[model samples]
Target: MSSTPSTVLDRFLRYVQIDTQSDPNSTAQPSTEKQKDLSRLLVTELFEMGVLDAHLDEHGYVYATLPANTTKYNVPVICFCSHVDTSPDCSGAGVKPIVHTKWDGSDIVLPDDLSQVLRQSEHPDLTAQIGNDIVTASGATLLGADNKAGVAEIMDAVYFLINNPDIKHGTIKILFTPDEEIGRGTAKVDLEKLGAAFGYTIDGESVGTLEDETFSADAVKITISGVSTHPGFAKGKLENALKIAADVLATLPKDTLSPETTEDMEGFIHPTNIEGILEKVTLGFIIRDFTVAGLHEKETYLKRILENVLTNYPHSTAHFEVIEQYRNMKEVLDQHPQVSDYALEAIRRSGLTAKRRSIRGGTDGSRLSFMGLPCPNIFAGEHAFHSKLEWVSVQDMQKAVEVIVNLCQIWEEKA
Candidate 1:
């Protein structure tokens, strides 16, 4: 391949430099107001690309439209969506994107932090990028390629469609959402305003991967109340809430049923937060599985763990509450098979073998699918996302751009 990079690479480099990390603890729709910075910029770029209706709303979502170019068939409107916000798991500020041109198969040591090294052994996808340009953060911060790469790819695809009007296509909608990392990507999304019959979130990892199945998710909050007493007078009378919470956690299976122990298709009970005093403590957990049955099974198992732990402390009481997060999109996607079939054909047209797989986590598409959009996830070439070791390849992004273009054309042709 030539050393020349595509416009998608430039767009990705430009977008990642802007810090848009979403805060999980915030109550705002976007969770972080700074996320709108990227949303606004995306709108500006979309307007510059001749997308007249491109605008950012108060909810930190950038919506735009590429009018239909084909008059032959009544093609259903489709959308290309991506999140602008990065994860709070790592610093997204001052992201110095280092593009290693024609990278050899070697470990990449990020300059800012010498200990932050990217090895092919750790990142299996690097083997395919033997001579391709690889992008990484300058240590101490994430690359923001998680969905910024998707954002740039969608931007370029829209730009391409506008420039090459001869490549006939139906009306295509563009959406740039915020706070996806904190699970609020579609919190304020106005689907009626978007008006897309189908959608694709270009936010998956690997070059040729397309994901339609996502984890059915639920959030569990456990509040433990314990008898608090004076330390000097405390004996058997003291039932510390912190100790009760610790006991429950300690009782969880050490070799299984955890994020650290789980692998492909395996669901896990992940403890996200734990906070409290000796009198009361709140433990937060997230349960994930492919099926709704499996999802509930995990939740039941968890409640059982809590019950067993509380039996030892007769004075202590616990409350377990389960909040529905999102369900497996595959349920809705299965009913609209054409959406994924068209995507697979498009991926094949992009000169790559389609690698269809299930996502271990959820995406905005998960909620959108049940919301009547039948959206699936497409690859954006992002890998090891939400961490300093995150990376993307220039060649892979260009291929993603091609896939987007082909997918739109496929929709037009099929219509």
Candidate 2:
């Protein structure tokens, strides 16, 4: 089964036009109401395409089951999932996508400011994309290609599967999740309802990149308290919490730390927020490492620094809390090598070489894998994610749809 670039581009544009940026602070399911705008459309489209079971759950997860035509083989139920939400880091609203009809391997301008060009000098990958129609934002907002492309591809694949029943497939499940950007996409996923032995999330970048490994992550919250006094008499009586907070912040090693300073297998302590003043202060940090032992070592290093500070400043107290966010999915995926191997062969059959890549950030697949699904991530052919400069080749986007269809066919062949 195959789809043209135009079909995939039209679907992708329609999805990106909807405002579905997730709110991390929201207390509701789906995180933001606007996310449903896309979910409802997806549900409507699925039903129109003859997927009777397609419907949105109470929490806004859209699930549809395409029942197998041939039950003799007892094929394994497989799932293809993607999130509908874009990152809260940028505006996903009012996206004006500009398609370069045929990119000439040069810099392209976004909609808001023509002066702000997505320079080829900065992105050498664009050189490989010459003569391809690239979809990009107008500089006013992010293109929402992060997972919108994923959603579009999933939709395209579903249509392809329906139109071509002779292709042979097992029971295929499709899920469009919300709030993946805020790290809660899998929170409401009913695993039993999904009924897939293993799954693939169409949420990665490039044509061949497969991510089955991710960092072990945790968040640390630190609060400091001190006695506030009048400036004139404060020299001896006051213990400035702001100063102590600065001291503690300075204690984190400056030599090799933070996301900007590290890459690949390296780990870092990223300081995300700080607030309050002289008498009280609060801080938040995200710790990430590829291995559990390394993550634990980083935690020990952080605890040691705080203990030293508390010993030096007895009157000024501090409260520290560490919460584990997600673990390395490798532990779970390693137990089921067939999941990764199957996905690899599927990509190979699509005429693209598959390369395994370790994701610096975790995915919903990480949580799902640990939850006993043994899920891995497949590429959606997007790049420069979570930014206004983000873009994706229309050719690549359609190829992703082909890959999904091929995966289903490959699974059936093996069965």
Which candidate number maximizes TM-score? Answer: 2
lDDT of 1 by residue, 1-415 (tens): 2233357988999999999999988998878889888888888888898999999998898999999989966899999999999999999999999999999898999999999999989888899999999999999899999999999999988888777778989999999999888888988999999999999999999999999999999999999999999999999899999999998898889998999999999999999899999999999999988898998899999999899988889988999999999999999999999999999999998889999999999999999998889999999999998889999998899889889999989989998
CA lDDT scores, all candidates in order: 0.92, 0.88
How many backbone clashes does every candidate have? 0, 1
Each candidate's root-mean-square deviation in Å?
2.2, 1.6
Candidate 2 residues 1-415, lDDT tens each?
5332236788999999999999999999989988999999999989998999998988989999998876556788889999999999988888999899888876787759776589888876687789999999999889999999999999988888888878889999998899999999999999998899989999998778789999999988888897799989987678888888888889888778678889999999888899999889998889999998888888778878877976767788888888999999999999988888988887887888889999999999999998978889999988899888899999888778888888888788888
Whole-model alpha-carbon lDDT for candidate 2: 0.88
Residue 211 accuracy (lDDT) in model 1: 99
Q: Indicate the residue-level lDDT of 107 in model 1.
A: 93
Q: How far out, in Å, is residue 234 in model 2?
A: 3.0
How accurate locally is residue 354 in candidate 1, as Cα lDDT from 0 to 100? 98
Where model 2 places Cα greater than 4 Å from the true spot, the runs are 2-6
- What's the TM-score of each model vs. the native? 0.95, 0.96
